[model samples]
Target: MKITVVGAGAIGGFLACKLFAAGHDISVIARGATLHVIREQGLRLHTGNDLVIAPLRATSEPKELGIQDVVIFAVKAPALPAAVDAAKALIGQQTLVIPALNGLPWWYFLKSNSALSGTRLKAVDPDGMIERSVPTDAIIGCVVFPSCRVESPGVVRHMSGSKIVFGEPGGGSSSRISEVADVFLRAGFDAHAHENIREEIWLKLLGNACFNPVSLLVSCATDEMIDDPNLNTLFVEMMSELLELGNRLGISPKIDPLQRIAITRKLGKVKTSMLQDVEGHKHVEIEAILGALISVADLAGAPMARTRTVYALARMRAKTLGLLPE
Candidate 1:
């Protein structure tokens, strides 16, 4: 199937290399030095043991790729709004727009079964720009559980995990979702189709909403942050509030917060995506990870005092670092 990756960083490069090697027609929309490197040498993937280079059509202009069967947007949250026009260029009438992003997405509640459906998370999509630009029918909800990083321009390092879940907003199973999962499976991902991916989204958010910002603020890795008594206590409080808010929002996950935290602590000495952003001086996903949750919590009439505290602190830090508007 014809596919286009909107961003060629980290997750995007990982999937692109695998998919391209698998003989799929892959096109990457990238810019500047990264684009130049990929265009000249192809995208490179180092899966810890194996190094693979994928020959792909790389261009900063989305129109060059034309319509695609699937357009995977792997952009950072803050850059998503500006990415709309490019994303639209590759989206045909029957195309699928899968946003493989962190935290909560703007399309989360677009047409879901949740009571939160139709409610706008302005934190993620200010003024409903995404809603207006991308049609609801074309949106396919995606949640990724992999840990990937860009080692350098055109070089992606896959640390671990490869579970990518896809779900249609209208609920239930669809042949289109199965097809998408098949492509991921072919690319060596543990892919699954979910009737309700929101549950998985919430489960993942439990750790990210807390740990990512905390790590950025303290300039520490996950192990060092969780090792501190004060940090551990704060983490528990944040998870508890998220659980409360998630339940109110109809997100039911079998795993509890403590179990989730235990799983994360096991990873040890890892830097979160947000911390990576801070170190790279790139825009952090504050609104996508925390601001969106706060908006939903308010909609659910759920108390999120602890979560709100973290959000406020993180936003301040982001502004101070020039990661967010003053």
Candidate 2:
């Protein structure tokens, strides 16, 4: 199948490489040094034991690549509007936009059956550009479980996990979702179409809501954030508020709050992507991961004192260090 991967950083580059190796017509949308490197030396993937180097159609301009059968968006949440706008050139009449992003995705409530159905999240979508730029009916919700980091320009290291969870936003198990899943599975990663993906989305958000910001604030790893007595207590309270919000939204989280904390603790000293972004002097994904939850809680009439407090503290800390803007 014809595919284009925008943002070509870590996950994007990794997917592009694997899919390219699997005989898909893959193109990468990258920029600056990364674009130069990929265009010069193709793309390089370091998968622990093996290194796969393959020539790729790397370009800085999305319009240059033309429309594709599928567009896998892997840009950060704060960069969503720009990402969506940039992806427009690749949207054909039948193109599927699969957003492999973190935290609460912008398309979360597009086709929901709740009272909040069709509600657009300002924290995530802001102006509904993503919703408008791409047809909602062509959107395929994707939750990435792989851990990877850009080793350097044109080179990415696969850290852990290979699963990519996907489902229709409206809870429909269509053949299209399965076809997309098959594409990834045939490329060698674990891919599956979920029945009730809302639960899965929340379950993943629970991890990000508790672990990511707290790790950034405390300057600790995942295990440290979960194992530290005082920090772990704070994490539990924040999760409780989130769980309560989930209950109000009619989505039951598969993992209990305490058990979730335990799992994080066992993950052991892994620095969260948010903390890493802070360390790199880059914008962290606070708004999508935490801010969106807080907004949703308010929309659902759920109290979020603990979540607000934690979010405020983290933002303040980041602001003080010039890591975030207000």
Candidate 3:
């Protein structure tokens, strides 16, 4: 399969290297030092215990690569609009666009079976740019679980999980989902197809919604925040609102919020992606991870008082640090 990874960050690097090693024609779109390093030295991925270096084609401009069979949209939320615009070069008639992003995606309610049907999340995809650029029919909802980080400019470290769940948004268990899963399976990871991708999305969002903001606000690890009585209560309250909202949205999450929080608390010293963004002084995913949820709550006519308070604090922290626009 011909694949183009858009972000070329930790998860993108991992996917590119692994898929390249598995005999897929992998093209990565990157910028700055990361692009330079990948072009010069290929991609170095350290799975903690093992290491693999796979040569791949790297370019900043997507037009340089031409069309691909699949374009993995692994970019951050803030970069989605630009990424979608650039990704047009790689989208052909049969091209599949897989978005491996976090939180509530732009197409969450399109054709969904919910009262919030036809809702558009401006927090994630403001101004309908993504919907305009990437049509809903070409989209395959992807839920990624690879815990990776950029060890250096061109190198990535795969920390824990290496699984991804994907499905068609309109509830058809199509061959495309299995095709993508086969790619990942051949690359030596757990990949599965789902009928209800929204459930998986919300299941992942439940943990990220609470833990991510708390980490950014307190600058503490997941276990530390989970161990704190005050933080635990705060997180549970936030989860309660999410659960209620999910109920209203017709997505009865398989795992309840408290059980999910308990499972996360046991992970011990794991730093969330949000905390990493804060420490690196990069633009955090505050709006996508937190603000979007608040928007969902408001749209669902659900109460999110606790999440609102946390969003205010987290957004304020980002604003104070100048990571967010005032």
TM per prediction: 0.97, 0.95, 0.97
lDDT of each: 0.86, 0.84, 0.86
- 1-107 per-residue lDDT for model 3 (tens digits): 88999988888888888898899999999999999998899889998688898788999999999989999988878788889998898998899999989888889
**140-189 per-residue lDDT for model 2 (tens digits):** 98888777877688998887778888899888799999999998999999
Better of 2 and 3 by lDDT: 3
Cα lDDT for residue 278, candidate 1: 90
- Deviation in Å, model 3, residue 107 alpha carbon: 1.1
Q: Residue 246's C-alpha lDDT in candidate 3?
A: 87
lDDT of 1: 0.86
TM-score of 2: 0.95
